[model samples]
Target: MTRTLVVVGHGMTGHRLAERLRALDTSGAWRIVVLAEEAHPAYDRIRLSSYLTGGSRQDLALAGRDFTEDPRVDLRLGCAVVSGDRAERTVRTADGEQLPYDALVLATGSEPFVPPVPGRDLANCFVYRTFDDLDAIRGAARRGRPCVVVGGGLLGLEAAHALRLLGMRPHVVESASHLMPTQLDAGAARVLHRSATGLGLRLHCGTAVASIEAGPDGAVRAVVLGDATVLESDLVVFAAGIRPRDELAAALGLERGERGGVLVDENCRTADEHIWAVGECAAVQGRCYGLVAPGYGMAETVAGRLAGRSPRPFDGTDTSTSLKLLGVHVATFGIIHPRGGPAAEAVFAEGTTRYAKVFLEPESGRLLGGILAGETGSRTALGPFVGHRPPADLEQLLLP
Candidate 1:
């Protein structure tokens, strides 16, 4: 019997789920329909900031950009699934179209969080999320104009770098005591702050945005800090954080996490068997993953289940990240800071070239996790060592 599968959302995870299912389901027992809210099909959202530099919209495409050619696939771009009727096994679109499905998968992903502040709705104010948002910012940015980016996390720093690439001076405002406080410890954050400052980025750590002041024409003019200091700005970008898009899940009465995400089991299945959840929208064990790697893992898990194959249970993710942030090579994996415990620790720093730290089991010398900044050539050898014992000469192996 041929079954119908309706996938809600066409982001990277959604696209990945479709690809995985197609590759696994060689018997052709199921036909798939992908509903995407965005006008364009799925693209590499991780490189969204790259569009501001030299990368084009087409360069960020996931796969070959054409899934419609597949006989078993129905790709519907700019079509949003407005609601679900579980008993009827049907979903309604925003355009008042109804589609029936034997099974439904929710991969609605997440939305950018904008902090509520006065003048946040000003003309030149923006949130860094989509290509459209970047285009809007690019249109408003002028050479020598000053831009204020709220939040010093990865996205905020990316936005600052994008603005700098657009020929604008950027000021980063972070409420936390240090930049990337959640990702990096205080010591690493200090080093990052120095690197960012050397790159001509103005950093305002431990500062709160009291309000955004606009000009007479209602465009951004300045950002007022908690200490009454004003940062002159022609543009203001909010990259505070992200919140999962779980409105459909909420409306369907699905269990949710305390922090607002659709609750799912190890199989990525919701309370109802016919419906499954994955990606940022699905919160497994009461925790939602905001990173792409975990979301990709969830997508793969759900795809395996849909393929009717005995796949391994979804058991969380490593939460490790390796990327270049504003020309700085930064990599953090496992437990960078462990509570008082018996773990072998090694620290190596070579001036401005690199700062590397690794944690290992005391007796077995098994690698747990570590942090690498500046020169991360050691990441190649150290990354695979996670969860396994390194070579006996591990200390010499990490030399820059």
Candidate 2:
């Protein structure tokens, strides 16, 4: 009398779905099967760069050590679902195994976006996505060699740091006018730029890659900028961006987003009631969140519904980010930019030591958004104060 549930893509979000379902489904009404493309089970992709710093594979694992001990759960690593039949309620694997499911959930996550440039497929070039990719980069990296990293966002900075750890000269190339264009404003980026350069890392802002020039051996020799500036390099890494892996859902005629992602409702359900989507692959309310926190929230919502509990709709998520880049603290939360005209802004800076800015309502003194660079001791208290009015004596609390 038990129903079968097939969960596709065993990334962090899919693993979360399985773990939560088994925990809440006490009646054992549904048995779960997890299909993963990678040979390894779920590991934290957010901390992937930590692998370069002596962090082992097991250290990045998200699931428990005894994850597969449960009798109701089946974990199939390196098994990819090739096709799905909605009418038959079945899925076909790459090795010709057919799986029947009363319900199906897609957690395919995403893939890195490599820009179209000549010589991109050269031998010394790579993308920072998986454990294997890091292994390849480390194996190929020569000490004292010059390395070029495209993009200057979170992942790009992490890659540059990793290269520096490997004893390579790292140069970060950003097409945007400033670093972390989507996350930090000009002032915060300037502080980050200074900090990065202080670490012996070079910065090339507002410069787009025109092409990668390969030597006679077909390995990377140098990178040509859009403005015809050529910099010699032995390695190139593209940390441009990521796009959702919604092809499987798209094949089944499921609705998708304008850019790319499997469109889902508030409950993370697709057009077919039995089919659901979560993680970076899912477009909740017509937008896909690339962060693990939001994906974890969606997993909780889906697990509840499958357990016959009250459905909690995934309304939206905050784009808050808090992390250390090259040993420097960086955190940004809630509406870094204002929407309704100009708002009252406060600025605090002391040379290159630290910089902090807070935006408040001109009339009501309500906190709208803020950016903190160089020092973030106040982030622990200030992050929660977003969208609310702070106390009158808030200046003392934010002082470095």
TM-score of decoy 1: 0.93
Model 2 regions more than 4 Å off = 337-345, 361-364
Tens digit of lDDT per residue, candidate 1, span 2-76? 999999999999999999999999999989999999998899988888898778999998857356689899999
Question: For candidate 2, lDDT tens digit of each residue in 88-135?
Answer: 999999999989999999999999989999989999899999999999
Task: Using lDDT, give the best candidate's number.
Answer: 2
* Every model's TM-score: 0.93, 0.94
In angstroms, give how far residue 64 of model 2 lies from its true place.
2.4
- 175: Cα error in model 1, Å: 1.5
Q: Which ten residues in a row have the lowest lDDT in candidate 2?
A: 391-400
Model 2 lDDT vs. the true structure?
A: 0.87
Flag clash pairs in model 2: none
**Runs with alpha carbons beyond 4 Å of true place in candidate 1:** 63-66, 335-346, 351-353, 361-365, 389-392
